[model samples]
Target: MYGQGMSLRFGVLGLLAEEPLHGYEVKTRFEEMLGGTWKVNIGSVYQVLQRLERDGLVEATGDRGDRGRQAYRATVAGISGLTEWLEDPDSQPQLLREDFYVRLLLLGRQPNGHLARLLDRQRRVYLQRMRDLADQEKIARERGRPQVALLFKGGQLHTEAELKFLDAVVDEMGKE
Candidate 1:
């Protein structure tokens, strides 16, 4: 399915709300928005679109696209739903099944030195991620995508926070 469930539904709805597009095109546009950070399968895109259409959030535009592909657009209700979702806060940081958390949990069962090495490696990776995000943010701003730039900035902050958490773990674990 989608990388982030529920969120992808709203993203698809928001894209359709902006303009009508075929399912494939919607997938392409959504990837473009995230600058290819997230990828949803074609089948998943159609599934989300189908669910949204069934939920009355979107409708067929009755317009055929290139090669007769069906196009979809957000309905009035879809626009309202999208707006509501935009204004609503996200529920996250539950830490359930998060990759890093799972890794840390499983790796903790291993021999002592494994976790220490992992923490050091992970810290370096996060630092590099921060640098990469700063570069990405600059390019996004230069491309007149302030929103995209903000997304990169958000990623940078998240990475930094994760690094801080790792540091705390290392401090308590004492390189053991």
Candidate 2:
């Protein structure tokens, strides 16, 4: 369901479900909500919004100001669509382009002590990401974006788990 469409569409719907917002508000909120992980251009957001409106999933309200700021609200169809998309089965597994994982796989061919250093560095980086995710989660919760909060929480948990696993690997290597 999510695969057949751009993730930005669902994200925009989710945002609109909260409250009516202008295009500029949507763009700023989207970037803020994703913690800058998803860089959505203004053109793309407007395009998706236009498509959503054309599909009758969203409706635009009157201009709000002298700048011609038109606000968009999620229609009943949009809410249903977003709910269905969230409930859909794994249309596609998330693909992570993890350079560290690739390096770890190739570490056996490297010189002495290199793997240990790399793993140590990975642990540090993962810990930092965990911290960042935690911070994002907190911000999302404070801002009343529970869905965004949940996303960041999941990321934090995954990073914490990876950090723990990396620490174990480093310890085992040290004993070898």
Candidate 3:
């Protein structure tokens, strides 16, 4: 995966591409979208939004409510920037979280049944994630963000590959 900062920036742009929203709304939507797997700090979201606005990638629309909350929308340049990033083929190679690999390594010593169960659980999770990605891609397509759809399609491919790999592992365990 990309660095947290880059991922967070992409996420903010993605949200704004859907609709203009206040800072809090952005954070809330992000959490909701990630299913709480990601926890973004308010300060970090605000800082990125400020930088984006400064770079003219995004613009502050106007204040909302009596408390004067500022709302942000993605500028045309922002959408173009996101599309460029998505199309760039030079993305850093994904770095698997070492902790999960370590756990898998340790678990490899266990009986085949245990490994089979683990792989089964992983396959299910990957399939569900792929379904979610497909749904998101459809939404992006409907919104005229073909770039976002492409990104989501990549994610779907990754999930499908994982599911295939897990299935192989489960089969190997059965043979053992």
The numbered model that scores best in TM-score is 1
For 38-69, candidate 2 gives per-residue lDDT tens digits of: 78889999999999999999998775856888
**Per-prediction tally of clashes:** 0, 0, 0
User: Model 2, 39: alpha-carbon shift in Å?
Assistant: 5.9
TM-score of each: 0.88, 0.67, 0.54
Q: Which should have the higher TM-score, number 2 or number 3? A: 2
Q: lDDT order of candidates, best first? A: 1, 2, 3
RMSD, every candidate, angstroms: 2.9, 4.1, 5.9
lDDT of each: 0.87, 0.84, 0.80
Q: Lowest-scoring 10 consecutive residues by lDDT in candidate 1?
A: 1-10
| Residue-wise C-alpha lDDT for candidate 1, range 2-96, written one tens digit per residue | 23457789989999988899999999999989976788899999999999999999999899976899999999999998888788666564556
In terms of lDDT, the poorest run of 10 residues in model 2 is 90-99
Regions of candidate 3 where Cα sits further than 4 Å from its true position: 1-5, 9-40, 47-92, 98-100, 171-176
Residue 150, model 3, lDDT: 83
